[model samples]
Target: MPEPARDPRLKSLINQLQPGPVRKVKVIGFDGVDVLVQLMDAEGEEAEIGRIPLYEASMRRMDNPSELFELGQEISAEEIGRWREGQLHLSARACEIPALRSFLLSIERRQIVTGTVSEVHNFGVFVHLDGEPDGLCTGFIRVPDLTWTRMNHPSEVVAPGHRITAEVIIAETRSGQVTLSLKALREDPLIRFADQIGRVLTGPITKIIPFGVFVQLAPGVEGFLHLSELTDEPGETSDRLVDEGELITVRVAEVDLQRHRVRLCAADGEGGF
Candidate 1:
């Protein structure tokens, strides 16, 4: 019979160190993807035990471990898990810090918070707040809230390390989410566009569907050109007349402020092309 896989002696020693902030660790080397460091005793003066691994070492994906850590540099991390077969893990994300979490939760809804953009994705932007909770970015700005303009991406409005002020939309302490909105700081462009009712507007066909075509009347403002209104022919699909990116003129039939929609119809002899 084969002997049972034995737990290393280091497991017991690591079990004694509770999961949280690791107070004293001197970065010694990098094992390809992880930062190898030595844990020091409480006095912060003497080496306590064997070397431990700081996995990933950052919340954001990094190409090189050296970008995050250097030799002989002292740093702190939240101990997340113990070694199973010699694999200790730590997390360096800003959201995992206790003081940072507390400060984020205390922020009131609709209150403006100042932060520097840490990362920008197609979906949203992450912000690292200033003042007491520095370095820990717990806030997020979704794509729609990034701007009043209808942009294809968030990078158009903000970039990494860009200073921004956003209104807190929600503060969920348990999940460590502080949702923010940059558009909340500005007036809605739709309100101004609403004044153009009954006027002829021309724009390239942005999207086409079986029911209707969508025309960009203005930036962030679109009007639906229903099939029934596209041509004199009663039973026709919208695509029969206009293709996408073809400029056409349409009259704004109605502006539904409650629904925030603009209904449009082809202007005299201007349905297609």
Candidate 2:
């Protein structure tokens, strides 16, 4: 390919092609090694599609293989020569275009990827996913998924310039927007605890309210320890029976999968309710 200017037709999806990785594989060419790379989305996510043999493609594009600092970077001509010297000569083949076509055709817009968070906006985030594409990653972290009950600012859980791993739950190329979820990756607490219904376990007080005490049966999972179930005297502070991190054996009373709710009581399974 000539040192050409950007194509007006590809302006929509072409991220500046860059150097990729190298590894050991058993192909006739190369040192029995190969490289893997990803096509990234705006949120610094891996698009489901990308080059088949990223190393070879990258080497062919990059003139200076040693100068390629990271994956998803632009390539040069010298690197291509190195690949040829290593017995992987695409230029010598009669049908070079077919092999190269696979890499260019597999570009994708939906997939999970990891990146250093560049900035946090009121509604979303922006991460510099190398040089390929720098776009906004929008959506909320949901109330129940906050993980910290300290009434935090979005910056607290994930600071500006911090690296976060998120799932690509929503990716519509037509809009260039995406939604991520930390909770989706999590096992539904109710479902997990429900499996332990017949087993005795302990819960620790997480929060106290007029109606009940919220006790944690497991991390990111909670159960209602109602005041009525407490073996305490009338008017006694709910905190007395259940304080934060105070463990008490409890039997699983109910598991509501729809609501992701769990109800617990004394492990003896004798509560009248």
Candidate 3:
């Protein structure tokens, strides 16, 4: 699926999107993963039909739409856009909490937001953003967005109650989340090393994998040395040739700034026999 943030359709929606005067709809039936509803006017009279896709049904996970709504149940939903079928696509999640949709709509890309860390999970960190409606924790930082350097866990960078400032990646009303990035505020450590390609440097092996080993040339800067470069002899495994923390000399073969990766080869004077 195309990322909503990068989708041109979504961009156009964001530019003109406004919150509220939420629509009132009455559940009519279910069509597979979609919940069919009848749009209601001020008089509560039924008008045209609308749809709430499974993903837009709720902010919380549910196996089926019936779990949240019943036949003839009246609910509030925001009209996001019309589906390809010509029926209006609505977001029940956006209207779940009052003012949440408005708060998310207020955030723009690259805008800095401040928040306090609420939870640190292996996958990401949840934050309670400042100025958000009470009881709403809308900020989130994925593991890669936490920092530029390698880390075993998010706790190494932030803990609960720690105040932090981050750039907004996206404000998703469908998910009721504001994707944030702390590393976006910091300079990439690999930028300085981009000019050092082809220079021979000695560093301890930081990690060894089945296909290659990683060498740390500087703080937070590491390069990959493929197993083939570790030995001229075929069939030699990486771990058999180098141990973790063992210092080895390697020449920078390539620096990929876009991907944040470095390629290394055996030093000119040193042959892996």
Q: Clashes per prediction?
A: 0, 16, 0
Off by over 4 Å in 3: 1-26, 39-48, 60-76, 79-88, 269-273
| Best prediction by TM-score | 3
In terms of lDDT, model 1 sits at: 0.71
The residue-by-residue lDDT of candidate 2 on 130-174, one tens digit each, is: 223323343333434433223335565676777666554433222
| Better model by TM-score: candidate 1 vs candidate 2 | 1
Give the lDDT of residue 235 in candidate 1. 70
Descending-TM-score candidate ranking: 3, 1, 2
lDDT of 3 by residue, 116-189 (tens): 99999999999999999898899999998999888889999999999999999888776788989999898787
What lDDT would each prediction earn against the true structure? 0.71, 0.46, 0.86
Which window of ten consecutive residues has the lowest lDDT sum in model 1? 1-10
Which 10 consecutive residues of model 3 have the lowest summed lDDT?
A: 1-10
- Answer with 1 or 2, whichever has the higher lDDT: 1
Model 3: per-residue Cα lDDT at residue 28: 97
Tell me, by lDDT, which candidate is best: 3
